[model samples]
Target: MRADRLVSLVLLLRQHGRLSATALARELEVSTRTVLRDIEALSAAGVPVYAERGRHGGFVLLPGFRTELTGLNPDEALALLVAGSRRGAQAFGLGSALASAMLKVVDALPESYRATAAGAAERLLIDPETDLLSRRLAAEEVPDAIAAEVLRAVFAGHKLRIHYAAAADASPEWRTVDPIGLVTVRDRGYLLATRSGADRTYRLSRILAAEELPEPAQRPDRVDLDRAWQERSTRFRSGGDQVTVLLRLDPARREELAGTALAVHAEKRDTDGWLRMEASFQDGRHAVWALWQLGLAAEALDPPWLRTALHDRATALATRYGTPS
Candidate 1:
C-alpha cells in the first residue's frame, strides 16, 4: 500500500507540478508526517523530487521526466508479482490491496510481457506453508481488531496501551509504550516500542488488547527499522541464561545437533568416527532436549548434571519397558 501511495505521490507531482507537504497529505488522505516520510523515500530512491524553502514554494519534480509501467523490466515486474504472492503483505492487513495492485500491474504491462510474466510468477512458489520435510511453518495469528489498533497507533504516532501476556503461565498485564514500528520476521509480527526509554519488542499474537492513547509518542521522527531489529536481535541472542555442554555424537547426527544449538564452540571427528563437540544452548533444559532426541546416537560428555539427568531418563524408560507396567 505504501508503494501505491508513493506512486500516487509521484503522479500528483507530475500532474500538479508543485504541492506542499500539507497539500500532498490532504490529497493523499494521510498525515503530513507520512507524506514527508514518503518524500524522503522517493529522494533516497533517486527520484528527482526537491523542495523549496519559501512559504509559497513546495515540493516539485524536475521538468521533462515521465513515469510509466514500461520503466520496470521483465524481471522487476515478475519480482513484484512474486512478492505480492507472499503472505507477508497479509500480515500488515494489505493482502487485498496488494492483490489489486498486482492486477493493475499486469494490466498496465504490454500484452507480450503481461501473460508471460504472470505465468512465470505463477510457476514460482514463495514461502509455502509446508517446507521440504513436510513440516508446517505456522504463521502467528493476530486478531484483526488488535492489529488494527496497533496499526492506527503506529501511523498516528500515539502512545499505546496493551494488555500483554509475557509468558504462557503469567497473566496478561497492561503496559503503555511509545511505538516505533511493526516488524514481521518469518511470518511472526512484532511491535518495536520503547517503555520508559528502554527498547521493547512485543509479539502481536500475545496482545490480549490494545488501546491508542491521545498523547503523541515520545520517539524519533525517523527510524531505521532494519537496524533497530538487528540491534534488538543481537542483544536478545547474547542475553539470557546460556548453557554449554560437550558431547559425543554420531557423525551423521552432528549436523542435527548443531542446527538446534545456540552456538557450536568446537567440533572434531574422533578416531572411532564419532563427533566430539562443544555446544551452547539457550538454557540447560534446551541442551537436554536437543541431545535427548538422538537417544543412543548422542552422548553428553561434560556437565555431570546433564549426563546424570539423561542417564536417569534412559534408566526410567528402560525399566518401564523391561517389565510390564
Candidate 2:
C-alpha cells in the first residue's frame, strides 16, 4: 500500500502538476498520515520534492524534476518505449527528443534489462508500409522538436509565430497565427489554421520555425476538424473538375486498387476476368498526377478535357526537346 501510494504520488505529481496531501491521500486510497510519510520518504530519497501550504497551493516539485525510468522490468521497459515512440512520432510529441530521452532511459537500466530493451526493439519492429503506421507522417519526414512544440501550443491554446517557407522560394517568411489542429492527408502532415481570415494548410516540412505566445489563443468552440477537412475537399471536388482517368493494369494493380484508398469502397464486381472502376477526382489536373502514380496501367478513358490536357503536356515535352523522330 505504501509503495502504491508512493507510485501514485509520483504519477499524480507528474500529471496534475501538484496535489495537496489531502488530494494525494484521496487519490491513493490512503490516509493523510500515510501520504505525509510517503512524501517524506520521497523527499528524503533525494526526489527534489517541495511543498506549498495555504489555500492556493500544494506539494510541488522544482519545474525540472524529471522522473527516472531505471527500475522497470523488461516487459515494462519495452511497453514504455513503444508507447513513448508512438506518442513522440505519431501523436505529435517530441520525435527525436523523446527518442533521445528513451535512449537515456534505456541506458539507465540494468545491463540485462538493456539487452531486453534491445531485444524488444528488434522483435517488435513495425513495418510502416503494410501497417500504415507511417501514413500519418510525411514521406521521410518526422515531427521535430519545433513541430512538437507547435502542437503543444495548439493544444494549450497558445498563439504561434512561425517562419514558413513557400514551395517556390528558398527564403522563409515569418507569420503570426493561431494553430487549429494537425491533419495527415495522403501520407503528408499538415497544420490547418486561419491566417488573415483565410483558411490555409501549412505543411510541417515547410515550417522553418515556431514560437508559442504567452497570451492564450482563441480555440474553436466546436473542434470539428474532420468537418473542416471535408468542406475543403468538397469545394475542390465540386468545381466541375473531372478526370477521365484510365487504368491499364494487371490483376495485382486491380486488386490493390479495390483494397486500398484508390477506391472509396470495395466490392467484388464479378469473379475472375476484369474489374470496372469508376474513378473520380477533383479535376483532370489532380487526376493526372494520381494516375501517374499508377505507372503503365493508368490511362485516360473518357472526357475530352483529360485527353486534351495529357496531349498538351506531351506536346510541350516534345517541343521542349524535340520529338523522337
Candidate 3:
C-alpha cells in the first residue's frame, strides 16, 4: 500500500504541478512526516521530486520529468480517453488539444493495451455536428458576448461600461452601470441591472459592448436576488395586463406543482387519500400550456373568465382536429 501511495504521490506532483507537504498529506490522508518519507522513497527510486522552503514553496517535480501514460492498462487508457472526450472540450475549442493529449496517453500503452484502446476508439464516436452547435451556443455566438460579459459583471458586483440598444432608443448608446443580475425566460436571456441612474432589464442579445471598470466597487449587500425574483413574479401575476388564473389540481398534479418555482403561489390539502392544490399563474399563456400538458388531471378552480377562455381555446383546437362539417 505504501509503495502504491508513493506512485500516486508522484503522479499528483507531476499532474497538479506542485503542492505543499500538508496539502499532499491531506489528499493522501497521511501525516506530513509520511509525505516527506514518501518523497524520499521517490528520490531514492531515481524519481526527480524536490521541495522549496518558506512561503510560496512546496513539492515540485524536476522540469521535463514525464510520467508515462502508456503505463496504464488498455482498459484504463480507453476509459481515460472516453472520459476526456465526454467533457465536450472539443466543442469549446479544446477538442484538438484534448485529442493530442489522448494520443500521447495511448502511445504509452503496451501492444495489447494499444489494440484494446484501438477497439475502444473505433466504438467511441464524437458527435461533431451536435458538439459544434452546442459549443457555438455556449461560447456566445448567438448573443452578443460583450452584453453577456457586462451582465456577468453586474452579477459579480463589478461596474460596467455598456454600449446598449434600448427597446425604445434607436441608436446604440453608451453608459456606465452597476449590474445586478440576469434572468432567463424561455430561450431568451435578460440582464437585470442598475445603471448609475436606474433599474432595467437589457436584452443580452442586443447588447453591443460591456466593459468592466477598473477596480470596480462592490454593490450594496442589500440586493437580494430571491426578493427581486419574487417581486418580479408577483408583479407579473397581479399586474392588470396579465390575467391571474387559479387551478385546482389533483394528487398527481399537485405533487408535480409542489416541485416547481411556481409552488410558492400554491396552497395544498389532503383530500381522502388524494391531494388538492390551488395554484396561481402570472399569465394564461403558461397556464394554458400547463393545462394542455396536464391532460385530465388538472381542472380550473375559479374565475368564470378563465373557464370560458380555456373552453374557447379547447374548442378551437378540437374543431381543427375534427372533420369539416
Candidate 4:
C-alpha cells in the first residue's frame, strides 16, 4: 500500500507540477507529517524531488522529470481502453478527464501492445446514438455547472440544494438533501441522497439546478451504496399495484414476454412443447399491452379481463385489416 501511495504521490506531482503538503495529504488521504516523510524518502532515493520554503512553496520535481512505471499487462491495458470507450463517463462530466487518463495510459504502454490494444478497441462499439431501426437511445442533458456542483457535494460530504422536476409534476421543486454518492448507470447519472433521513435517488438530468450547500451532510461515515440501491430497487418492483397473468406462449416467444413483464413468477414447458408462465405486471393494462406486443405467439391463459382486452384488440385489428373469411 505504501508503494502504491508513493507512486500516486509522484504521479500527482507530475500532473500538477507543484502541490503543498496539505494538498498532497488531502489527495492521498494521509497526514501532513506522512506526506513530509514520503517527500523526504523520494528525495533520498535520488528522485530529484525538492521542497521550497515560502508562502506558496511545496514539493516539486526537477524540470522534465518523468517515471517509467507503466507496469500494466496487455489485458489490463485493454480493459482500461475499453472503459475509456464507454459513454457513461460523459454523464458525470468526466469525459475530458477519462480521455486525458486514457491518453496517458496509451503513452505509457509497451510499444508492441499499444498498437494492438488500440486496433482492438476500435472494433468494439457501445451504446450507439441510433440503432439499425433508427430508434435513438435516450441521453439526458446535464448542464456542466450542475454536474460539477453535484459532484462537489458528493465528494466533499456536504448537503446539496437542488431544483428537481419530478415526472408527475409540471414545475421543479427545491429541496435540500444529504448526498451519499453519485452513480452513473448505462448512460444516465443519479444522485443517491437522503432527505430528513429518507433515502432518495435523483436522476441527474431531472435535476434542473443544484447548489452545494455549506452545511455538512447528515449521513453515516461509511455507506454501502450498492446494497442501498438494491434495497430501493426491490421495494420499487414489489410496491406497485401489481397484477399477475398466466400465459401460454411458444417456447421461442418466452423471452419476449419475460422481457416486458415486471417479474416472472414461474415457467414450465408442456408435453406439446409450449411454455406456460406466470408473470407480474404493473396492472391489467400493462399486462395486456405486453402480451399484445407478442401478437399470435402468446395467449392469455387466466384473468378473464386480460383475455377480453386482448380479444378486443385482435378484433379491432382484424376489422381494420378487413380479413376475408
lDDT string for model 4 (41-86, tens) is 8988888889878999989989878788645443234335446445
C-alpha TM-scores of all predictions? 0.67, 0.52, 0.45, 0.68
Q: For residues 1-325, write the lDDT of model 3, one tens digit per residue.
A: 4754665677667555789999989777689999998999888989989988789799999987866632443323333543443333322222233433455565556646866876887896753434444653242222335643653576457787777777635788987777776655433456666665566567665667778776563467667776776776665556554444566666766655554424345555646544445555546675666666676776666667667777898899899989876
Candidate 1 residue-wise lDDT, 248-305, digit = tens:
9999887788778877889889999998998888988988899899888999998999
Per-residue lDDT of candidate 2, residues 262-297 (tens digit): 333222343544444566565656666665556555
Error in Å for residue 203 of model 3: 5.6
**TM-score quality measure for candidate 2:** 0.52
All candidates: CA RMSD (Å): 14.1, 14.3, 16.0, 12.4
Per candidate, the number of residue pairs that clash is 0, 2, 3, 0
Clashing pairs in 4: none
Model 1 is weakest, by summed lDDT over 10 consecutive residues, at: 69-78
lDDT rank, highest first?
1, 4, 2, 3
Between prediction 1 and prediction 2, the one with superior TM-score is 1
**Model 3 whole-model lDDT (C-alpha atoms):** 0.62
Per-candidate local distance difference test: 0.82, 0.63, 0.62, 0.80
* Order of models, best TM-score first: 4, 1, 2, 3
